[model samples]
Target: MPVLTAECDPRNIASIALLKKLRFEQTGYAEKNFDYGGIEMCDTAYFELKRKT
Candidate 1:
């Protein structure tokens, strides 16, 4: 089967570690803003991942 990849928050240390353990690589990044309750927050960092063969 072909390998699949996904993107997630790098702020989540556990998830980043798991992806590294699985051989995922940082390919690109993007900016995103989200609203929680009544507050808006923005993130500026590389948040992309890819499978490494």
Candidate 2:
């Protein structure tokens, strides 16, 4: 089996809702460094979908 993984900013409620609607499950949470305008620590929500066998 394989898994599809993704991460999104925790503050984005719309994205989170969309992911949930698509049947992806929240796997974990973490703080990740991102370089949007400059390097900064951002809280992330991890999601994953496991392939049905």
Candidate 3:
């Protein structure tokens, strides 16, 4: 079996677009996703590649 994933700052439009072009399906999201610097927070989006048969 083969699989792939896309995880990155949700603010990155280019990256998100590229992932979609690569056939990854958006699956999840989170707000204030993590503590980047103990002061600043970040948002994130997750995508998974479609399984091939």
Candidate 4:
């Protein structure tokens, strides 16, 4: 089976590096509004991950 992972958290440098090391590529992405403490915000970013062979 193929595995997929997405970086939805903010400013995760280590995770980005690890994904790159694992040969992950940026395919496509999407975002939506999230409410926290009565504030509306969204996690904006591109998707990255590797597929298992």
Candidate number of the best TM-score: 3
Q: Give the alpha-carbon lDDT of every model.
A: 0.57, 0.87, 0.90, 0.59
Q: Write one digit per residue (lDDT tens) for candidate 2, span 1-53.
A: 89999899999999999999989999999876555565677888999988899
1 versus 3: better lDDT goes to: 3
Backbone clashes in model 2, listed as residue pairs: none
Tens digits of per-residue lDDT, candidate 4, 1-53, equal 66575654345677667766777765645465445457656554455555657
Cα displacement (Å) at residue 50, model 3: 2.7
Q: What is the TM-score of each candidate against the true structure?
A: 0.54, 0.80, 0.82, 0.46
The TM-score obtained by model 4 is: 0.46
Worst lDDT run of 10 residues, candidate 1, spans 42-51
Write one digit per residue (lDDT tens) for candidate 3, span 1-53.
67787798999999999999898989999999778889889999999996888
Could you tell which candidate, 2 or 4, scores higher by TM-score?
A: 2
RMSD (Å) per prediction:
3.9, 1.7, 1.5, 3.2
Cα misplacement distance, residue 47 of candidate 2 (Å): 0.4
Query: Rank order by TM-score, top first?
Result: 3, 2, 1, 4
Q: Tell how far residue 43 is off in model 2, in angstroms.
A: 0.5
List candidate 4 segments past 4 Å from native.
1-3, 29-53
Report the error of model 3 at residue 13, Å.
0.2
